[model samples]
Target chain A: MKFSILVSEGPYTHQASDSAYQFAKAVLAKGHEIFRIFFYHDGVNNATRLTTPPQDDRNIVSRWSKLAEEHKLDMVVCVAAAQRRGIVDEGEAKRNGKDATNLAPGFRISGLGQLVEAGIQSDRLVTFGD
Target chain B: MTIKKFMFVNRKAPYGTVYALESLEVVLIAAAFEQDVSLAFLDDGVYQLKKGHSTKGIEMKAFEKTYGALEDYDVTKLYVDEESLAARGLTADDLCIPVETMSRAALGKMIEEQDVVLSF
Candidate 1:
């Protein structure tokens, strides 16, 4: 089945991001197609490359980035939410006069329209949040 | 594209977190997709519809007015849980907009019929 996931919370603060990551992994393991993974609200924090966890800890950001890279996953962070939380990409950094970009690899900043498009195109849309 | 029944199940209060407003943003965008969209208000989500919301003292942007623009987006299926309303001492008349009051059981069945169930 084609599935789309919506994550609405950031890592560490809530289990929504972890649960979404696990669920996405399980779906891929089960040989299901993930149409998209949309990050909204605080969930956009998962796309920042600036996160540096302890060497012993599970780096949630890297986990998602690697999964997205391996699977060629369409990981999208809402532009509005990302801007509000300072998750700017290269283009946005230049446009908004920011010093540098922090968007992690394998994730693109997009509009909420991507989310609605996911709902229309995918067979199922699952949301995880507080 | 398939016409999916997308239901956003809101169970949280507004302002404490960004869920309510962010959920509304999705709904507004979903309108353009022309999917069958519905908004279910249960638990503390019922408070989102209460009339006369004041965010002045809270120092937050009062988005209660945004709810009124939902109709313009062609996304108007708003369902409020009857039990939740009664528990919170609110009635349909107290809400910012008109809604269909359904029993929790009925709403459960409705949820079962949805292709996508988004909880916030």
Candidate 2:
């Protein structure tokens, strides 16, 4: 099986992100392929590398980064949502002359049309929402 | 793109918001175009499947009854997540319509088999 996941919920506050992570791990273990991971709405929070959890708690941004590094996954954060939440990549931050870039290497900023394309291209489109 | 199967994962409460209703209207119109349409309710969305719901004092139109009309639209693949139901203290018997309830794993499998999946 192959899939593209749609995430509409943020980390820490909702189970949707956790569910998506679980599903991704299960799919990969099952020998399935993931075409891309589309983050929308609050889900873009998953791509914000600046987030800092308590010292003992798990950092979702790091988790996603590690997963992408191992699997070469496309962690896509929606441009509109990222901007609305103030999550900018290096390019965006540099272009806008922002002080810093909060997005990780495994993640890329994209548009909703990519979501429509993901639905069109993938064998499966699973959505994780709150 | 030509969509063969269309699935709408309803995450919002049926009332007090326009997202769910607007989404339903979109799916209905899609079904009219001869697309395969299905609805899966999760989280607070389980409240959307309950029966005997009426909105009078709230001055909002009752959309619960519209579930019946879905069949007429050929939008018959109704599903509810088992955990979502238990957490909400709801059951299929409490619903006005019959639904195929399954675990998240099964639901994920179903979603993977669809051509397009939308959540609201």
Candidate 3:
């Protein structure tokens, strides 16, 4: 079965993103395909490379980026949400006249259409939110 | 393209948080795909459709009117939970738009039949 995941909360502050990452790992280990992983609302914070945590704590953003690299996952952060939260890519940074792009590796900024497309394409759509 | 049954489950208040508004944004975009879309309002989400919202004091956009425009996008399947409405001291007459009020069990059944369920 193919499943798509929606993470709607930021890391550390909420467990939604962590739970979503674990679920994604479980799905892949069970030999199921992950159609996409969409980050929306505060969940877009997971795509920022600027996230810093205690040395002993789990680095949430890196975990997602690493997983996406290993699985070639289509990790998408909603552009509107990302813009509102200041998670910018190079193009967005240039277009918006920002100084830097903090979009983490393996995640791309996109429109809500990608999320709707995930719902349409995947056999199941699971949302992890507040 | 194959059409799928997409349901957006709204369970939050409109003003206190941004979930209700963002969820509606997705519904509007999904409408363009020509999919079978339905919206479920339960819990505090029922407040999203309440008539006569004044957000000027909160300085937030009064998006309550957007619900009426949803019909123009061919996305009019709005379901409000009867128990939730009653619990909140509200009724169908208090809402800004026309919706089918049903029991939670009935709404759950409808949700079970959907290909995708996106909760907000």
Candidate 4:
């Protein structure tokens, strides 16, 4: 089955992002195709490269990037939500006249249309949030 | 692929968090896909449909009016849990839009029938 995952919370602040990450990994491990992982609300925060964790702790942002790299996952952060939370990509930063961009590797910023497309194209659409 | 039934289960109130508003945004966008879509309001989520909501003092955009746009989007399956409304001293009359009220059992059955369930 093709699965699309939506994450709506930030890393560390809640268990939502971790649960979503685990669910995505489990789905892929089962040989299911991941249509996309659409991040919204505080979930967009998960795509920021600025996140820094303790040396012993797991780096959630890098973990997602690595997973996307290995599987070629289409990880999208909602542009509207990302802008509101300051998770800007290079293009968005240039367009908005910002000095910096923090979008992590392997994740692209897009509109909510991608989320709707994920739901329409995938067999299952699962959301993890508060 | 066949058309799948999608249910968006909203169990939270508005303004207090970003979930309610963001959920609505997804719903609006999903409408364009022409799927079998429904909105279920239970727990404090029932408050999202309450009429006369004013964001004047709160300094937030009053999105209560946006619910009215659901009709224009061709997404009209709005289900309000009767128990949730009664618990909050509200009725279908208190809401801005016309909605179908269902018992908890009926709501549960409806949820089970859906191909996909999203909660926010």
Q: State each model's TM-score restricted to chain B.
A: 0.97, 0.93, 0.99, 0.96
lDDT of 2 by residue, B1-120 (tens): 466777888887888765576567657766766667788888888888889778898898888878888988878899899899999888889888989999989998998887787978
DockQ per candidate, 2 decimals: 0.79, 0.18, 0.89, 0.67
**Candidate 2: tens digits of C-alpha lDDT, residues A1-130:** 7799988788999989989999999999999999999887778889887789999998888998999899999888878677778889878898778898888769999766566666666788888985
Candidate 3's displacement at residue B20, Å, is: 0.4
Pitting candidate 3 against candidate 4, the one with the higher lDDT is: 3
Candidate 3 docking class: high
Ranking by DockQ: 3, 1, 4, 2
Off by over 4 Å in 2: A94-97, B1-114
My TM-score estimates for the predictions, one after another, are 0.96, 0.60, 0.98, 0.96
Residue B24 error for model 1, in Å? Answer: 0.7
Docking class for model 1 is medium
- Candidate 4 positional error at A100, Å: 1.0
Candidate number achieving the greatest lDDT relative to the actual structure: 3
Question: Where does the lowest 10-residue lDDT sum fall in candidate 3 chain B?
Answer: B111-120
lDDT of 3 by residue, A1-130 (tens): 9999999999999999999999999999999999999999999999999999999999999999999999999999999999989999999999999999999999999999999999888888899998
Say which prediction, candidate 2 or candidate 4, comes out ahead on lDDT: 4
Per-residue alpha-carbon lDDT of candidate 4 for residues A38-94, written as tens digits (9 for 90 to 100):
999999999989899999988999999999999999999999899889999889999
Higher-DockQ candidate among 1 and 4?
1
